[model samples]
Target: MKNVVSYLFLLFILGACSSTKEKTGTSQAEAIEQQTIRKIDVHAHYRYARPYLSSFFQDWIMQAVLVDVAKEDSTGINRSWKQYVDMDIENPGVFYLCSSLVGVGIDDPDFATKNIERLKNEIATGAKMVKVWKNFGMVTKDGSGQFIQIDDARLQPVWDFLKENGIPVMAHIGEPVQAWRPLDNPMNPHYEYYKNNPQYHAFAHPEIPSYETIIAARDRWIAANPDLPILCAHMGSMSHNVDMVAERLDKYPNMMVEPAARFGDLASQNSDKVKAFFVKYQDRIMFGTDFGNYDPAVDWTAEQLDAEQKDLDATYNDLWRYLSTTDSLVIRKQHTRGLGLPREVLEKVYFQNASNFLGLE
Candidate 1:
C-alpha cells in the first residue's frame, strides 16, 4: 500500500478543481473535451527514487500497480497517471518512462549498446518516451571516472536506437538555478533528495560552464541527434528564458518542449516572455507536472516529508494561477499564462505532440 499522503495527493491532483474557469466565447466543457487525453505524460516516472524502501516511491520498475492512477491494462497507465495525480484527466495519456541508462555506468560503448538493448526490450514491452534525468548534469560520470554530459559519445548508440524506433526522449538536464543555490530553494521542501545526497548540493564547477553553457550543451545534444524526436523536458530546462526557448523551438522542427512543473518563479518573473513563448510556439509545447515520488531522501524521516508537502503545494498553486487565470497582464510582452487555450493547442500539449513524437495513437 502507498503512504496515506501519496494517495491523498493523488486524490487531490485528480479531484481538486481549478479555482477559476472561463469560456472564451465557447462552451467550457467543449473546450475541455477537445484538449483531453490524446496525451501521454512522456516525462513521468512510474517508480520512486532510491530513498523509500517499502513505500510506492521506492518501487522503481513496477510500482504503478500500487497507485489508484495505475492500471492493469496499458490504457490504465494513462488513466492512473491523471486520476492518481490530479492532472486534467479529461485527456490524460502517454506511455511514461524513467529512461536513463547513463547512470548505469554506461561509459563503455559495448555496455552502452547492451544497455540500449535492455531499453529496447522495455520499449518493446510498451515504453514510449525516454527520460534523461538531471543526474547527467550533476551526478553521472564516465570512463576513468569523469563527468559525462547529456551528449556523451558513449551514449550515441542508445540515442541512435531511440531515433530509429521513433521513440521521443524527454531529456531533463540541468538543475534549476535555485536547486544549486545553497540558501535559496535548495531548502525548499520539495527538495528532499538534496538533504540526503550531498552530491546534489555540491557541484564540480559552479561557475565553470554557467547556466547558459549547460543549456548550450543541452541544445548541442539535441542538434547532434536530428532524427530523434526529442522533447526538452522542463521547458528545455530553461524556464528563465522564454525567448531563447522559443528560438530553439522555431529553429528545431524536430524539437519540442513540455511545461512541466514550471509556471512559478518563471511566471512571476518573465510573464511576458513566457506568454509569448506559449502563444507563439503553442503547438511545440506540451504540459507536464514533473510529479513523482521523490521521497527517498525523506523516507526515513517524517519531518522531511512534511517539508516536501509545503513546497509542493506552493508549486501547485503557481501552476493553478498561471494555467487557469484569464487575466491579461504584461510581464514584458503582453500575454497570458493560462490562455485557457483552444482545444487543438491543449490537445497538442496534453496529448498529440506526445503521440506523434512517440508514434502512439
Candidate 2:
C-alpha cells in the first residue's frame, strides 16, 4: 500500500511538470509570432511625442511616417513641422518625417527657389518624403485669384527638384468622388466630411473645378514627371472605385498609393474584387491609417489617453482582420467580408513596400 501511494504521487508530479512546459511553450510561440508581425504606417500625422504613443508603436512592432500639410496658417504649420521633426528625433526608427513646402505663395517669383531651400533644409534634418496637400489644387489661389491646379507650370521646378533629389512625393491633390455628390448617402465614407466642411463640398459649389478636371490634372502631372516616385495618399482621392485606381496604377509605373482613410470605401466594395485587386497590385499598394492629432501640447487626462489607446487598439485590430482574414466583419458600420490576403502579400503591403519607398531598412 505504501509503494502504490508513492507511485501515484510520482505520476501527479510528472503530469504537473508536463502541463507547465506546454503552457510555457505556447506563450513563447505567441511572443515569437507577434515579433514577426511587423508593420509600417506610411501615412500618419502624429505631431507630438508622447510616451504612450511610443509604447503603442513598440507594442505593435510598428513604425509610422509623420506627414505634414502646408495649410493656410503658416504659424500652425511651422509648429506642427517642428513637432514632427522633434518627434522623429526623439523616436528614432519608430517615426519618420514627410515634410511639406508652404503653398501659400506659389504665385511669387521666388516660390520654387525659396521652397527648394526650405525642402533642402528639411531633408538635411531627416525628412524622407514631401507631402503636397489638396491646397495645391483646390484651396490655393494665384495673383489673379484663380484656383491653382496641381499641374500648374509654376510648380514644375519644385517637382523637378524633388525628382532630382530622389525624394518621393505624397500627393493628396483632390477629394473623393463623393465630395462632388450629395451628402444624403450615409454609406459614403466622405459624407460627414463634406457635410461638416461645406467649403470643400463641390456639390454645392459648382464654380469649383470638377472631380474629373482635378483627376485629369493629377494624371497629367504624373505623366509629365515620370522619374519622380509619387505615393498618392488616400488612394489618390479615387477611393470610391478600386477599378479607377487600378487604371491609373496600370498606366503610371512611378505612382504608388496608400489606402489611409479609404479603408471604409474599400470595405464597402465586393470582398472578392478587393482581394483580387490587392493580389494584382500587391507591389504598388501600402497600408496607412490616416490616424492623427496626437498632440502632446493638449493636457490630456489619464482617462483620455486610456480611451485613445483603446480606440487605436480596436482600429488596428479591425484593419488587420479586414486585410488578413476572411471572417465577416463590420467596418465603419458596413457589414463586409475580409480580403483573406496571403501572408506574403500582407508583408509587402503592410511593411516591405513602404520601407522600400522610404528607403528604410
Kindly list the per-residue Cα lDDT of model 2 for residues 33-61, writing each as its tens digit.
Answer: 44577899999988766658888899889
Q: Candidate 1, overall lDDT?
A: 0.55
TM-score of each: 0.64, 0.88
Q: What is the lDDT of residue 94 in candidate 1?
A: 18
Candidate 1, residue 255: lDDT: 87
C-alpha RMSD values across all candidates: 11.0, 6.7
Q: Pick the candidate with the highest TM-score.
A: 2
Poorest lDDT segment (10 consecutive residues) of candidate 2: 23-32
- Provide the lDDT at 274 for model 1: 56
Which portions of model 1 show Cα errors greater than 4 Å? 1-39, 46-98, 180-198, 202-210, 270-272, 293-321, 327-340
Candidate 2 Cα lDDT to native? 0.85
Tell me how many residue pairs clash in candidate 1. 13
